[model samples]
Target: MMGNFHIVSNNPMVAEKYPDLTEFEKDSKVKDIFAEGRNSIHLGANLINHPLAGSIKPNQSPYKSLVMSNEKGELDMFSLKLIEGALQVLKKFPPRGIEYDEQTLEDFQVIDLDLLDSAIDSLPYEYHE
Candidate 1:
């Protein structure tokens, strides 16, 4: 099984000029809170009292190792599993280095936008089981 995540951001300037994304942001509450709490732990005591924290931490958990976990716990079995998982990724499929993106920002003015559109639309989509 393979999991892939892609992030495509619309230009904020484009939306500002056109005003289409403003409605979406308004409805989603995306812009309402730029950040949630106090900037630091010393100042964040009040914000730390959320009910979600009660059930989120598990006993003898991985959080104890890397997150809330002590240093000794991290050097134990959990590190073994972490190393194995990383090795699996490397063994199964190593990363490919980019070899073909020679275009510079200056080359953009000469590029054909229609060809770019056609190339994007020509790719076939595959569904994972």
Candidate 2:
């Protein structure tokens, strides 16, 4: 459920849609988001969705969003490994050197939000209770 999760993202649309649930890092890069999620995982939070979920390559999108459990307990090894691997894979792709126009940037934000929404929608019904 929405209340059980935390959103780490640089996408403004996601923050706007779920302000209370988001850890909005307006200036963070994709790797920054992944690293933040990894840090949270180290603190015992689990990943609710893959960091690299969509078809858009890491280098292609300027915005990234990750959903993680709000509850902290024993460290989640799976989440830690996943986020760490994502960070490593991200290092392989060079940054998008080309500057995007405002419209293109907004489109990227929409795509990131859509992926996050999909993950939320796929959660089991009991989690929403």
Candidate 3:
């Protein structure tokens, strides 16, 4: 039943009649997708940092206490930047509406990925760690 309608059609009347989705919702959707992307990248990061991970004490899995001595550290910097960029994207395209609903996700699609990608790419390749 949900898929019965022409959601993305150019029909002016249909678009006019349908409930409008907000920019905030659209931004939220992008953030959700970006988060998923960040997670996937983190998995890759974990693999890439396997050697460093191995060095950590077995009792300490997630390094919350990693003290960066005068040197730069090898951490989840890439993932951090990805999330930051994603947040910035949402801010740049803040939801035009005050709130969101289930239908909002269905009503929107990613219009741009360049901004988020650039943020992620801007992070340094390696740190002093």
lDDT of 3 at 42: 52
* Candidate 2: 10-residue stretch with minimal lDDT: 120-129
- Residue pairs in collision within model 2: none
Tens digit of per-residue lDDT, candidate 1, span 39-113: 111222121111111232221011110111111211344334433443343345433442434343113212222
Model number with the top lDDT: 2
Model 3 segments more than 4 A misplaced: 1-28, 45-76, 88-93, 98-129
Rank ordering of all candidates by lDDT, starting from the highest: 2, 3, 1
Best by TM-score: 2
Error (Å) of candidate 3 at residue 64 is 31
Which runs of model 2 end up more than 4 angstroms from their true locations? Answer: none
Clashes of 1: 3
- C-alpha lDDT of residue 78 in model 1: 37
Candidate 2's clash total is 0
Residues 14-120 of candidate 2 have per-residue lDDT tens digits of 99998988999999989889989988898889998988955888889999999988789999988888888888888988876889999999999988899889988
Superposition TM-score, candidate 2 onto the true structure: 0.93
Q: Report the C-alpha displacement of residue 21, candidate 3, in angstroms.
A: 28
lDDT scores in order: 0.23, 0.87, 0.30
What is the alpha-carbon lDDT for the whole of candidate 3?
A: 0.30
